[model samples]
Target: MPRFAANLSMMFNEVPFLDRFASARAAGFEGVEFLFPYEFPADELRKRLNGEGLTQALFNLPPGDWAKGERGMASLPGRQQEFRDSVKKALDYAATLNCRLLHCMAGLVPAEVSLTTATSVYAANLAWAAEQAVPAGVKLVIEPINHRDMPGYFLNTQAQGADIIAAIGSDRIGLQFDVYHVQVTEGDITKRMERYMPVIAHMQIADVPARNEPGTGEIGWSYVFHRMDELNYQGWVGCEYRPAGDTVAGLSWRERFAR
Candidate 1:
């Protein structure tokens, strides 16, 4: 069976933290992912998840003061300490929540930084994260946001993400393949999925253009899901799209997956 997860950050925007898990479960998702989850107590979150029977498929390290426009600086030289600190905190949280994976945010890139420098920084940080995560039975996933959606972001391509994971060379270090980002950046979604499926640790989706529910945009989600099924992908397929109206109203297309 293909497990589906609702990204709380994208869906159920009106729900509170303590109640979001149930909302996601009520919305028919078997699991949930989030950008971050350090806002509340981990034990309490674990208890809530246990009660709701919702799995923590994915959650990210803090993006570091988004209000200051800091969209993560993990691969920057001077910010290494900040990146490690963020990872440490996230790992502690993941342990409490019994999460299987954690996304190590690769923040915005500086104009002066070379690609060599960025890749080296990311590889080094990921190698360290892999070392820390493997013992805890958690994988470290790095995402590639499309340039259009996140300009100057350090990691922005499936190939680039694969290279970074290859550099780290650990089972614990892998890619978070977001179909929405990859579709915007790379049009050949099926081929790219097939090519990187071996190294992809997580998957997320929405639609391009408006980033709404599946089937609302140019990407052929039916084909995409079919391809995923054909590949026998056992990981969670996360719904990481914005709701055009109310969350539930926008999720009616889920009936397509009822079979």
Candidate 2:
């Protein structure tokens, strides 16, 4: 069976960040993940986790100036220094939290930069990022975000993500397979999961067409869940979605899976 983690950034928006920890635990989540943790000190977040007896499953490296519309800096050329700085920062937090996985988002492909340049930079960045992550015992992950959801995103397909991981040639570098994004971009969820299971370190979920809790849209959640079990996906499956109603009330889907 797969372990489920509450995505504090998306699902538990009804409360303050600190309070979301307890809310997740109350809702029966054994682990949790969030978009970014730079706002509060790591110690404070740790206090909440220890209090709730929950584990920090995963989190992202800072996307450069998110408010300024930067998605991530990994693939952005001339930002190599900044990307390295971000990796060090991520390692610090991951070490402090004992979190073993970190998602590295590939930033938007700027119009002026050639795809060739961005590709080289992205591959080099991941190779370098892996050196730091491996020693820290943390795996660096790259997620294949869909173009429709993130219009200018550089990494947009499972094949592309797998290729990058293969090129980087490091066990420390892996894929953050978001089921919602993969279904939107590729449509072959089960096969892709099985095909990339060796390179996938973490996973996320949301129903298609709505990006809401499972079962709210077209995805056959039961099959997805059962398939992961059949494949023995021993990784965290993050609940990364918006709720259609009260957060707690939308948990029937999770309850059904927990059985």
Candidate 3:
């Protein structure tokens, strides 16, 4: 069976961030993930997880100045120091929370920066980050966000992420395969999943067209879940979608497909 994790960042908007832990537990989720935990102390987040008996599935490294539209600094030149500091801070939280996986976002590439330069910087930064993560017992992950959702986002395909993993050494870093992004950027989801399953450390899901719960969109969830089982993907499939209605009500898709 494929395990599901509630993405507290998107789901459960009915309550405060801290309170969503209980909401997730009440909703029958055994694991949880979020975009960022920097707003609260690591210990406080850990306490919530412990109180709810939920596993901390994953979170992202600090994105630079999200308010100013800075998604992440990994591919941006002259931001190596900031990126390194972000890595150190993330590892600290990972240690405190006993979480094993952290997603590294590849920020938007400026028009002035050529793809070759950005790719080179991204690879080099990931290499350094992976070296640091190894001793901490934390495996880093990189996600390929769709350009439609995050325009100019440096990473945009499973093949690209897998190549980076191969070059950086898969032991240190892996891929965060997000279903919605894959469907939007490129179809043939199952084939991509099968091709990259070996390097996929974590997975997330949302329906295409509207990014809602699975059954609300065009995806054949039954087959997707079944294919996951066939592929022997033993990782959390994060419910990272916006609820069209009540969050709890929309989760009925889980029973319908994940069984």
Candidate 4:
């Protein structure tokens, strides 16, 4: 079976953010990931993780003033300084939290910038991030979020993500391949997983059509787990989905896959 991490941001909304570490551990998760840790002080989050004996599996870098609808600024032309500053801040938190992977969101494209400019800026930003992350013992990752969940998201497909990785051409950065997003954008889930396994740094899970627990949708998670083993994917598979009902009650899929 694949090693699983509870996405505390989405998985344990029943409790406060800091308290979700204990909730996740109580529910048998060995690791945890979340959207952002910038709001919480690094020491405080580290204390909770130490108390629960959980590993910080993953988290995204600051996505530029999220409340204002700015998802990220990486691909934006003039915000390069802000983007680099976020990477440094994230590295500080990752060092304290012992998280090796940090995702950098490519915010939606601006109407003023051409696609070529955005792509060039994206690659340059990623190259700078890789330069920083390589020395910090962290991996910088980018994910292709399905456009349905995030319309106008700059990066919206594995092909696009792979291209970015290729352009950067560094080991310190990789793709955060969310199965649900791939399924939503492209149906060849397992084949794509295998095809891009080399550049895949971290993976996330959510069933398609509903973006809920596995059995609630059509994904054959059993086969996915078995295939992951066959392909030797040695990274955490994050449970980044909303629970259909209660958080813990909808964990029958975990029970089924927890070998």
- On TM-score, the leading prediction is 3
Superposition error at 62 for model 3 (Å): 0.3
TM-score for candidate 1, residues paired by index: 0.96
Residue 157, candidate 3: C-alpha displacement in angstroms: 0.8
The alpha-carbon deviation from the true structure for residue 24 of candidate 4, after best TM-score superposition, in angstroms, is 0.3
Best by lDDT: 3
Worst 10 residues of 3 by lDDT: 250-259
lDDT of 3 by residue, 46-145 (tens): 9999999999999999999999999999999989999999999999999999999999999999999999999999999999999999999999999999
Error of 1 at 205 (Å): 0.4
Candidate with better TM-score, 1 vs 4: 4
Preferred candidate (TM-score higher): 2 or 3: 3
- Candidate 4: which stretches are off by over 4 Å? none
lDDT of 1 at 235: 94
lDDT values of the candidates? 0.85, 0.92, 0.94, 0.91
Clashing pairs in 4: none
Q: Which pairs clash in model 3?
A: none
Sort the candidates on TM-score, descending order.
3, 2, 4, 1
Predictions: Cα RMSD each: 1.4, 1.0, 0.7, 1.0
TM-score of 2: 0.98
